[model samples]
Target: MIQKDSAMKLPVLFLGHGSPMNAVRDTPYSRNWRRLGQALRQRYGGEIRAVLAVSAHWCTDGTAVTAMPKPRTIHDFGGFPQELFDVRYPAPGSPELAAEIRSLLGGHAVAADFGWGLDHGTWGVLCHVFPEADIPVVQLSLNVNLDAPAHFALARRLAPLREQGVLIVGSGDIVHNLRLMDRRAPDEAGSAYEWAESARSLVNGWLENGDTQALTDEAAYPPALHLAAPTPEHWWPLLYAAGAAGADEPLQIFNDDIVGKSLSMTSVVFGHDALFEAV
Candidate 1:
């Protein structure tokens, strides 16, 4: 076995992917993501081994990872512009890494799932993060049957990959509730509900303070649990990113804003900021 080196450790990211349109549009959110990609190139001297993404859109019966090379770009969402659907990330996949992930999650139930490829949630963030699609990418599915704590536990198994130069990303909205959203005025930060702001604030605090248990406990936060999420898919990815973080690692929040009445644009970063600081 080749020993992992400390210099190769990559950072973990949890992006609040609001709209699929953001993939095609050159918005502030997309620009920020591009900056991170640029920073990665500068830091690792233009070589990021691979990316492992856990997206909200690819929920499965059990945890799984995409293991196919040249995996398909899935247009999972509908009613988007033709250009959005036409766009392709074209990032390669690593079966080796996927198998490694399966081995790591042997404590849990995880398999190599060849059926599902990269979805809107994964590609939308990566399009901006790695526009050239030069590096390999893999998508991990969220287990639909698991609760928040279980999701976090499964994600913790992936923490070792960071040391092997895999960028672990959890893509989902921190505060996502389309049912209560003001559809007419989507992406409105000023009109964000007070309760939504409070909800994200609590989560932000939990991430910053490294309070993983409190963050996962649904009963502790009834309002945010019931209202901010409504459904747990979008909210669950945060736990994945948080679980990958070291116990006392400091967190940095970026693109911090609420959009579309209920969706939050808040993104978080954990570890390996050498290039980020220079940028």
Candidate 2:
């Protein structure tokens, strides 16, 4: 087996996949995800066993990890084109990894289920990263009700998985205030863009520091964060990824930008050496 630090570590990603359009358009964000996926594969093609995605959409009462051996594509959103609905990511599911995830969380905190499949949050980005849909995947549900601290702790617990070649992904938008999601309001776009950019810069700092405390505490963030995240579900994944960073680990921004008023689709990658060096 490869030594933990010596072998390239699998980096964690925080993808700000804005609109459902990402599932279809070959825009910069989609292209970036694709390029990142290809680069990751080229670096660790045969060694990567599975991908564990923590999507913003599958928020439940408690932490649940999908254990199914063959997970399917779930069209979780509506009002999309038939072509978008038809898009599929056929990444296999890993039972062994599921068991390991359960084991990683210990007995009480983590639960397992067999049927849940990939939601738009997972496939929206993965469709680009692993377009071939060849790698096995496991979807881990977010405890929507859980606070940032809880999510951060959970991420720390999951840190070891990177050594084993599991790419942990956090899927959500940064400035996701649906009330202002106007595709046409120019004023709304400018304000939301400003907020998203500010928030992204602050978040980038925290990630680079691997500051678990700052990530968990709401007050530590800018005032805009409250507006960006009226709920904790979307931002919690970032805490998880950051907590998984240990200390002083380098964080890289894979994609960053604000789209529309309520959608900040800027995404990030943590563990610079782990990912870039290998690439």
Candidate 3:
């Protein structure tokens, strides 16, 4: 069956989009993202139909997907440099893909949003991924009303799109606690707190073992989760990718690093070895 074949299917990705500045900065994170994007074509060997992005920035009342013809690049964050604010990703929106998503997720309360556009959680990484901005993208808002389990089930419904050339990307941090960052630490570059690493390791084990239940089970994780994810919005995207992953898909973590002492820049790809093998 086509569903069982990796050659014709698109892989899923979970990107830790640390900061909006990475969109314009030539940092290590951005460099890795660019390399991974190039690897997608060489390793996957299929034409990309479109990109279906589930970003942490777009937390909606209900599930929504951007249906505009030309979606605007929204600098959703504040306190960034002027250059970062000037940066814009001119990626076109895909109404056809949006309609397809609406049909795929039948009876799931999916909305076609003309107002919302690509936020930093998306374009920040996408600008590095596909710099040409030639590919059409549709942003799916993470329904704030739903929990991790619900999000997981929601993403699973779109699994069929993988075989149709839609790249499913979940953009958020695994460990994102801005307040927990230690500014006092010297050489603040890519420094991780003990709690952050512990939380990452705990969650990594779940991902490696394909333990979706333990990942969503609130009681199963350690207290480090509190520090790792003070709010679940950022961490929730991981569950989306996890749900979209095949039952026995090969999962690999790359660009694994902790930034700002709390935020984790660890990114993962399912059903591909290029990103890891290249490095």
If scored against the real structure, what TM-score would every candidate get?
A: 0.94, 0.90, 0.93
Local distance difference test values of all predictions, in order: 0.84, 0.76, 0.84
lDDT of 3 by residue, 176-208 (tens): 988877657522456578898898888888888
TM-score computed on alpha carbons, candidate 1: 0.94
Provide the clashing-pair count of each candidate structure.
2, 0, 0
CA lDDT of 36 in candidate 3?
Answer: 85
C-alpha lDDT of residue 55 in model 2: 86
lDDT of 3: 0.84
Ranking by TM-score: 1, 3, 2
Model 2: what TM-score? 0.90
Candidate 3: give the clashing pairs: none
Instruction: Report residue 101 deviation for candidate 1 (angstroms).
Output: 0.4
What is every candidate's alpha-carbon RMSD to the true fold?
A: 2.0, 3.2, 2.7
In the predicted model 1, the residue pairs found to clash are 187-260, 188-260
- Single out the weakest 10-residue window by summed lDDT for candidate 3: 1-10
In candidate 2, stretches whose alpha carbon ends up further than 4 angstroms from where it belongs are: 1-6, 185-193, 273-279
Q: RMSD, model 2, all Cα superposed?
A: 3.2
